[model samples]
Target: MTIFASYSIKGGVGKTALAVNLAYALREDGHRTLLIDLDPQCAAAYYFRIKPAAKFKFKEGPKLAGRLRRNIRESDYPGLDVLPSNMAYRNFDIMLDRLKKSRKQLRSILAPLAEEYDSVVLDCPPNLTLLSENIFRVADHLLVPVIPTPLSERTLEQLYQFFKEKKLPPNRIRPFFSMAQKSNRLHREFMAQLRLDYPVFLDTVIPHSVHIERMGQRRRPALDYAPGLAATQAYRKLCLEILKG
Candidate 1:
């Protein structure tokens, strides 16, 4: 199974939106997809109308995987399941730190689900913590949603630097412009400059749209509620790009 993580050091850059929609898109394409909400906020799970997972005692590898498996809830949409996050997930870093191979423990924890899912999309929490490192180590593709701005650019650079310093595979990072405002000169400029500098950026750009922002109220992917909209089309295109890669 291919593991795709929607992550960023900076939050509010459309990370959860990407994860939620990507998982939906994958299921639409006939893949058995599992959306794992690692964020304690549980926004992804909330969007699917799934409640927060019950708190469970942390354990190593197989035990932890079983606990997570038990928490998996079938989404309203078929072929898509969600493993909602618990408030206790905030201690993931601490729990991972207790492992001998903390950076790689996530791989083992998630390995058991490989047989059941064709794709696993992770809605990761924002920050560069030990848990984030574990995510970096495990995810086949790290889908980073970068807004077209100086701050977002800097954070992307920081992410690359962290990968370099830690000797992680930077190639796994697939960044794309998120909440892009084509009308803004600076946004357009930054998008062009970053694409030129980082050839790895995805060609599909998710536009800043009210449809996307209303996901909280709609509690579903834009593709489901507004499939004809530009943002929804962008997400579908983005999913196709990742699948092609």
Candidate 2:
């Protein structure tokens, strides 16, 4: 499976929203997709109206695959399945730390799932940890959401620096503007600067819209609940851009 992680060092940058909609968009494009909620907040699962994953011990290879397979919950949408997160995931750092080659352990655990899925979307938690490092090692692409602002820009720089220090390929990280407001001068300026600095910035930008916030209330992808909305259209464009890459 091609693994795509929606990640950021800072929270509330629309990471989960991107994961949810992008997974749906992938499914809409006819790819068999699985969205794994790695975030302790479990917002992606909640968005898909999926139940929480049962607490289980983390094991290796086939054993670990069995545990994950048992928890797979089919979504209301066709071609999309969800592996919900539970509070047990908060202990991931402790679990991974005990394993050898911890930074690459997550890739091994997810390897077997490739046979069953065409794409895997991860909704990751904020902050850096061994688990985060494993995610960085495993994900085929890192979709980072940047809210056009000074603090968000600084966080993006920190992420790039971390990648440089770790010797991770910078091209693997794709940053895009989220919750952007064209009316705001600061937002426009920061976005322009970001584009000039990072030519890899995605062409599609997600706007700040109440409709997106309603995904929580509606418990569905925006494309499903608020069809033809600008936010939904933007997400579709982003999904296509991701696929093309």
Candidate 3:
């Protein structure tokens, strides 16, 4: 199975939205998709109208996989399932820190899931901790949502530098413009400059739109609630670009 992680060192750059919509798009493309919310905020799970259970106990390897399987909830969409996040996940770094081969432990825990899912989309928490290291080691592709702004650009550079220092393969990072305002000159300039700087930036740009903001109210993916909208179409194109790669 292909593991896709929606991640960024900076938050509020449309990362959760990317994960939620990409998972739905993958499901629509005939893949059995599992959206795993690693963020303690649980926004992706909430978007799908799924609630986490009262408690979740952390474990290692097989036990961890079994716990996740038990927690999986079927979404309203046919081929999509969600593993909602727990508040306990806020301590994920501490949990991984106690494990042997900690950086590789997440891959081991998620390995068994390949039998059940064609694609696994992770809604990752924004940070650079031990858990983030584990995610870096586990995910096949790191889909970073970069807003066309100075802070976002700085964070993206920081992410790349982290990968370089850790000797991780930087090729796994696929960044794209998120919440872009076409009429804003700064947005256009940064988008062009970033694309030139980072050749791996995906061609699709998810424009700033009211439809994406309405996801919280609608409690579903924009692809589901506003399929014909430009932002929705951009997500579909982004999904196709990632798949094609």
Best by lDDT: 1
Per-residue lDDT of 200-241 in model 2, one digit per residue for the tens?
999999999999989989999998888788888899899999
List, residue by residue over 56-99, the lDDT tens digit for candidate 3: 67755547667766888999998899999888889888878888
Error of 3 at 9 (Å): 0.6
Clashes of each: 0, 0, 0
| Candidate 1 per-residue C-alpha lDDT over 129-207 given as tens digits, one digit per residue, 9 for 90 to 100 | 9999989999999999999999888999999999999999999999999999999999999999999989999999999
Q: How accurate locally is residue 110 in candidate 2, as Cα lDDT from 0 to 100? A: 87
For model 3, give the 10-residue run with minimal summed lDDT.
Answer: 53-62
Q: Which residue pairs collide, candidate 3?
A: none
Lowest summed lDDT across 10 adjacent residues in model 1 is found at 58-67
Candidate 3: where are CA atoms >4 Å away? 59-62
Whole-model lDDT per candidate: 0.93, 0.90, 0.91
TM-score of 3: 0.97
Residue 81, model 2: Cα distance from true site in angstroms: 0.2
